[model samples]
Each structure stands twice: as structure tokens, then as C-alpha cells.
Target: MYEMDGEEIFVIDGHVHLWDARQENIIHEGGEQFLQCFYDYHTGFTPEEEQWDIDTYRHYGADRMTEDLFGNATADMAIFQPTYLDDFYDEGFNTTEQNAELAEEYPERFVLNGSFDPRDGEEGLRYLEHLKEEYDIPGVKLYTAEWRDDSKGWRLDSDDAFEFLEKCADLGIENINAHKGPTIRPLNRDAFDVKDIDDAASSFPELNFIVNHVGLPRLDDFCWIAAQEPNVYGGLAVASAMTTNRPRKFGEIMGELLYWLGEDRVLFGSDYALWNPDWLVDQVMNAELTDEQRDEYGVELDVETMKKVMGENAAELYDIDIEAKKRQFRDDDITERFDLGTHYGGDAGAAAD
Candidate 1:
């Protein structure tokens, strides 16, 4: 992990997703919604209902994520799960089995996450348990917003979702990442928001709760949550937001966040299935973080902070032996053989493939 400067860096990208069109029982509109969610933020670009298909996910997400992460510059590792699978329809809002196969092919660079709809009831818990036993999943992702009762979404506070969280807690699963609200569709009052769920984390203080997208409009709430509870952590996956609406403004607020939270509680994540990762990474890497601010926040430009932002904190929070995972990748040739698609450019988004 040590480079020529004797500084070590073990980067584990906290967010990544896999989408493929050729899998059995695959759904296209569901896939399109997923892309739309990202395009809404990333390219400030959205496709009409008719243009997004299996092909869109392949070109925009599956192939693009692979190319951006492994086909170019590398990170030490990545944390990944399927996105948008649980909400849309049949076999909705979930990653295809092909994603698992992709993980098997690049064990070192990727950490797989399992997702279960709160609507699945007892069946969801069974599925979760089966995933733990059958696959080497290091974490579980729950979009409690999908379960908000008032929003007509699945309620995270439902007995079923609560039971699922209890199951995750019982399993000693250290981290659970979830979305806050609707991504693509215009923000609706009915949207399931995560601000009301701190009791879940407070109830499970031992669990590491990662509130993804920092809950957007509820960013202050998330910060309050993190300040109020050790179990709560916030992710800075403001990729699309930074790109589309508030590039400079987002950077300023993020810098302030680093100052206030001291960086350890804030993670650098690019919702990678959307725009090129380089675009997101560069946004922050080039942000105006001050020398004192960087030092105070424990964000060194060298390998150390890189590792922390990329994966180490996630590894610690999730309890995965990243070094062990690295060894596994080294022992196999699969990473060398796996190919994603075209990437952002040369050497900009490289990581351990």
C-alpha cells in the first residue's frame, strides 16, 4: 500500500453500481428510471421515456462504470450494490445476477452490497439471510425512504423494515447505506425522506448508519444526526448536484462541511453510474480546500487522505479486511481479465481492477 513517498493509500470507492441489459427477467423502464435519476444530476441531461432501454444502461451505467473505475486509473477498492431495482416494477430496483458475477471476476476492487425491499416482508429477511450465507456481501443497503408510509412508499418504520434492520444488526453488519428521496421525478412532498429515521440509528447505536446523498435538502439534519449519534455517518456523493445545478456552491458548502465535521465523518463518493467518475472526483480534488482546512480536517493531499476518502473509513465502518480483499485480488487473475467499456479518458480514474 506504500508508494515511493512511503505514504500508504488504500482507496475503496464507497459508491458504485452495475447494470446490464442481457440478463434474464430484466426490466427496461426500470433501468431507464435509474438512468434518469443520474442524468437529472450528472449530465443535467435526461432521456425521454422512449429512448432509455437496456442499451442505455449498458452504455451509460454498466459499461461506463467499469471503464471509468477499472479501465483507467484505479482505486484500491470499491463498494457496490444495485440501484433503482426495488421501485419501478417486476424485478424492479435491483441489480441483476450478472453484477454478482462481475464481482466474482474482480473481487479485490469491488465489495458487493445486498438490497432488500421492505415490502418483501418476511421474504426479504429470508433473502437477506440467504445473501449473507451465499455471497460474500460486506454490507447491506436499505432505502428507508422507499418505505415512508405518508409518502405512499414502503415505510422504513414498518414492522417489516424494522425487523430487517434488526436482522442486519443481529448479523453484525456494520454499515447500511440508503437513499433519502426520489431521484428523478420532480421533488414531491410525498417523497420518502430519511430525516425522520434517526431513531433507527439511535435504536441501533452499534450499527454504522450511512445516510447516502447526505439527505439533500436535509443535509443539516444529517449533520445534526451525525453530531448527535456516533452511529450516523454522512456521504458526500454530490456528483450530480455538483455537475448540474451548484458546482461552485456545492464545493463551498462541502468545504465548510469538511471544516465543521473534520472530514472523517464526510466521505467522497461519486454516484458512478452517471457521469464520468473523473468529472466527480475532479470536482472535489480541485475544490478550494484550504491548507489549514485540509490539515484540520485530516485531509492530506497525499496517499493517506486519499485512502481514507476512497475506502479506508468504509472498510473500518463496514469491518471488511481490505488488505485481505486485496490479497484475494492479487491471487486471482480475474481483475486482469475483466473489462467494462470505454472510460472517461486516460489514467484519470484508475483503481485496482
Candidate 2:
């Protein structure tokens, strides 16, 4: 098993989603219920009521589709489980199971993340244990889009959820990636930003808490969180607005993060299904950054850092030795797949080695 060379750096996208095109069983078995509730309660939201619908995920499928979309892609993708439109089961166990199946099948390309909603008490904890024992998932993902402030009965963080996170730390699971985005409430745009995650990191210093999407609209706040909490990490996942509206500016965000936390603390992630793989790769490759900026900011800031951001940090954090996994695939043919330069820049190639 050879280490990925600096030039041949293989990327690992920390966040992506999958739905088996063949698995109609998901919707019939509680998926629809979950979606219905999500739409009714979250997306189709009014001032008094929040609205959300499964229609959000109208387009998504398994790894095969992802692979096809990322033809000759530079980075490897680590797929995570997606959430439903509604909160059918607070524990994202079923989704985790499906993700595990994909990871086990495609160990070379896909890394598994276990998702567990803290709302389900003991059942949620058991699910985390199950993921460790049965699926070998290396990380956990939580979505607080609908989290309610228990005292006021409005949506926000929950004490119960925080307690569950404390337990996750006790379980030897060091990484917890949480999603914060433009989904539900607005005023707290910066309120539940990545900085809010400092609470979890503070309570459980042993745990590595990654604030996903750089807390959506709160870039500065995300940077502050990473700056304050040693254990806290920030991510750039399908941040379409930033990447799309201002690619260079997005690189600047990365630059600031590097200034505060160094290269390794920030990670590369594509909220995949929401954003196409090719478009995201292009954004990163084209984002404005000098060699010094790249070196300082780490992955996605430049070609080399891109590789690290794609996979290395995530692999390190999750303890996934993909080099070892690649060795297991052992391709004697040494076939060169596709030249990744035309789209990515330098002539990057993948060998079946």
C-alpha cells in the first residue's frame, strides 16, 4: 500500500449522499412518513409554521450515479447518509445502515459515516454502537435543522441533544459532524453558526466536532468557532452560494480559516447531491489563491491542499487508512483510468495499482 503522493493526492469528499435507485422499500417503509412530516413542519414554512418536504431530495441515487457523474474526478468521495423531509425516526439508524452497505461494497471509493439523531434516547445510543460493531463507521453526522429550544418551544439547539453528544464523546467516537444551513430559522443565521458548536467541543474535548457547511451563512462565525475550540473543525460542503456567488471570495474564507486554525483544521466537503461533483471540483480548482495562500490555508486552497482536504484529514480524523484499503484492492493490471488534467489542471492519473 503506497501513500498517496503529493502530486497523486487522492481526495476524499467527506460529505455526499446516496439513495438506491432500486430500493423503493425506503419510501414505503417510514421514508414517506418522515418526508411528510419534514415538509409539513420544516420547508413549506410560514411565519407561524415551518414548511419542508421530501421534494428536496427528488433527485439522488446510489454510488454508481455518483461515480458516473465524477468521471475521472480528482478526489475520492466519502458518502454520508441524507436526512428525510420530516423527523420520522429521530435516530438516523436506517440511513446509516444503507450507507454502511455502500461503503462495505466500495471500500476503495466510499467511506462510511454513521448518522444518529439524538432525539431517540437509548435507541440512538444503541444505533451508534451498532454502527461501530456491525458497520465499522468511522464518524457520526447530526442535523439540527429542526432542533427546538426546549424552554421556549421554538426551534434551536436542545439540551437533550447536547447530552447525547456528551455520551458520543464517552463512546470513543471522536468525530461528530453537524449540519447548519439556510433550512429553517433565519435570524439565528449567525446564532447557531459553527461557533455554537464550541459548546459540544468544550463539553467533550476528546471529541472532534466539525461544523458542516461552515455554518452556512456564518463564515466569520465559523472561523471564530474553529479559532476558539481546539477540537472544533470547519467544513466547506456544497456551500453553493459562496462557491457560486463568489469563488475567489470563498477561497478567501478558506484563507481566513487557515489564518486562525491552520491548514489541517479546515476540510473539503461537497454537500454532493445538492451540488454536482464536476461543478464543485471546478470551483475548487479555479478558486483564487496564491501558492503561499494554498500552503497556509491547506486543502482546496491549492492543488496539493485540495488533495488533503478531499481525503487525508477526513481519513486521519476517521482513522480510515485508505492506503491500506487500496492495497486490499490490489490491481496487478496497473491500468491507468483517466487523465484528470483537462478538467483539474495538472495531469492527474489513477492507476489500478
Scored by TM-score, the top model is 1
lDDT for each candidate structure:
0.58, 0.57
Model 2: per-residue Cα lDDT over 1-353, one tens digit each? 11233354556676776543222444344445444443342222122221112443443445444454345454545557454323333333236665656566565567667766666668977877887778666567776654343421122145777766666666666678877654533344333555457676777788888878777577777777778888878777745225655656676777787688776777777655445455455556556766766776664455566556666778878776766644433331111233333322222324322
- lDDT of prediction 1: 0.58
Decoy 1 TM-score against native: 0.75
lDDT per residue as tens, model 1, 71-182:
5444546677565444453454446354676676666567788877777778878888887877756677766544222354554556767788888878766577877644
lDDT of 2 at 220: 73
C-alpha TM-score for every candidate: 0.75, 0.71
Could you tally the backbone clashes for each prediction? 16, 19
* Model 2: residues with Cα > 4 Å off, grouped in runs: 1-6, 19-59, 84-94, 147-159, 185-191, 290-300, 325-353
Q: What's the distance in Å from true for residue 299, model 1? A: 8.8
